[model samples]
Structure formats: structure tokens, C-alpha cells
Target: MRKITAGFFHSVDGVVESPNLWQFDAFDDELGALLGETMSKIDTVLLGRVGFEEWAGYWPNAEADQDFAQFINNMPKYVASRTRSQADLSIWQNSTLIEGDVIEFARELKAREGGEIAVMGGISLARQLFFAGLLEELTLITHPVVAGKGKRMFEATDPVTRLELKRSSTTSKGNVVSVYGLKPE
Candidate 1:
């Protein structure tokens, strides 16, 4: 079975919005190292149209030009969309747009051969997957500072769903990385 691995960056108080106001002079090698190690373990990359567009541009250029970006470029990516949205699909050499019944498509994708499929949170879509009981493992990488006003990761979009904690830890950057797996049957 294919599992979902999420790497989200949030605040101490649980927030996953963007951080554009921080002042940093140099890259935190420790944090980057930790993130790199974690990312190296995953294979598949799944994202919504918004998140796909956001990452397809940068990550493909940052990593070894063939590491993370190459993985994103060559590996399978399932993007959830309703209105035929294709934002720079060129970056993803092997990509497919998800329409119609997403759960079925996602399940089919999971059944195929692969290591771990990561679901990059776009908030709305993550809630959809959470409600559908399709998510296996969730990894939330939380940060230290809180954004008073920004987008939230998930807000109970479904009627009712439960997730049991699996593992969690604090990163060197004072960030908390929480891992959650859906309640087993």
C-alpha cells in the first residue's frame, strides 16, 4: 500500500501559512540537513494545482538539478483539480491531472508500485483527502514563530474524521514536526 508523507512548516500555535517577513542572513545548514534527510526517504510527490504550481517552479531548480526537483520532474505527481488547471506542467515530465472522482484515482495510484507518496498540503485538498480516509501518514513540520493572520493547514472540512498521533519531534530550528496516521481499522 502507498502511504502519504507530508512535510509542512507551521508555527508553534499550529499555522501553515507562508513566512515572507523573516530576516535571515544565511541558510541554517542544520535545518536544511534535517529536511534533506527527511525528503530523501520519500518517492512520490502529490499536490493540488496551487501547491503544484508553487513547487514545480522552484524545487526543480534548487536541488541537485536532478535530486528533489528531478524527482518532482520525473516521478509521478497527481494534482487535484476541477477546472482543468495546469500551471507550468512542463516541469513535471510525468504528470497527470486529476478530475472526476479523486478518491478512486488516488486509490488506484496508491495501488501501483512506489515507495511513499507525499501529499503537499494546499489546505482544502488535504481536508478532502483526510475526510475520504485516504491518508495513511501525515508529517507536519512546524516552525517557531506564529503568523497572526495566514492560511491554516486543516480546519475540519469534513463532517467527522479522526487521526491518531504516531510520532513528533522538535527540529533544531525550534520547529515541531508532528507525525499522524489515520486510525487503523
Candidate 2:
């Protein structure tokens, strides 16, 4: 089965949400490249409801922006939500709401014809996979910034688990790219 790739940008202090969020625009080139590679590997993009709405709003019209105008415009997306009633999505050729059980569904998806299935945001969804030993690898890009407060990353009740750093590198713009795979027991 294909592995699950969790990719997110964070700060030096491990803050995924930074104060100067405008810099995200500049990261589009990097984002596009990364996402391009991701889509080349996996066809499915797992997203939470909020993130789903945010992405759907931006990506469909990314053509207006030079960076992700081409890359983000394409690629199938799936949203994990309980409240969402509509499944019709214009951004992706194959977009749908994750119905029924997600863990088993995710696994079934990875087993489909693809290279990697990416999961973004929906920390609750990620935590579910992590605790169930379903997540395979984590790709984190740490930017050089910090935000004192925002949405919290981890829940208080989550347990500590070990992951092995498989590869790491620093981008020209000083972004830290770290890839961690689940440690073998």
C-alpha cells in the first residue's frame, strides 16, 4: 500500500500558524513544486472541513496567482467532514466528502492506484491515524518565524510516540524540510 504523507509548514518554535502569514504567498513556488510532486505520487488530498473550504476558495482561482496558478488548479481533493451535506466540488475532478469510517477508508484509498495520499490539517484526523498506527510519514517545513498564540497543534491527551527522521534539508529561503517516518518496532 502507498504511504500516507503529512505535509505542513511551521515555525522555528513549532508554530504552524505564524503572525506574518503573508509570507505564505511567497512560498507558492515551493508549495506548487511540493504539491506537484505530491499529486504526481498520490491522487487523493485529504482535508478537514475548514481547510477544505479555505483551499477550495483559493485553488480554483489560483490561475490569477502566478505561482500556484497551474499546479493547485489541478489535483483531486477530499474533505473529511460530518456537517457538510454537499459533495459537489468544482476545483477537483474527483472531490468528495469522507463518509463512514475514515481510518479504514484512508487505508483503502492508499491501497488504490497511487504513490502517496496526503493529509493536511484536520489534526483531529491526523491524531486518529497516528494513534491507530495508520500514518506512515510526516513532512514538515519549518519557516523562520514565530507566533505567540494561535490554534494549538496538539491536544493535551495525545500520547508521545517516537518517529525516525528519514531525511532533512534546508531550503534556500531558510525553510527547514524534515521528513520523519514511523520508527519500526
User: TM-score: which candidate is best?
Assistant: 2
lDDT of 1: 0.67
Instruction: Estimate TM-scores for all models.
Output: 0.79, 0.82
Clashes of each: 1, 0
Q: Give the per-residue lDDT of model 1 (tens digit) for 78-134.
A: 788776555546556666787678778778877988787777736666766666777
Provide the overall lDDT of each model, using Cα atoms, as 2-decimal numbers.
0.67, 0.68
Give the root-mean-square deviation of each candidate in angstroms: 3.3, 3.0
| Clashes (candidate 1) | 1
lDDT of 2 by residue, 1-185 (tens): 77777776766666654324624433645656765776577656787777777667766656566544354445566778888855455445456878788888887887787767778756567667767777787777777766556654556676887889998877667777888877889
Off by over 4 Å in 1: 20-30, 60-67, 85-88, 156-161
Q: Where's the lowest-lDDT run of ten residues in candidate 1?
A: 19-28
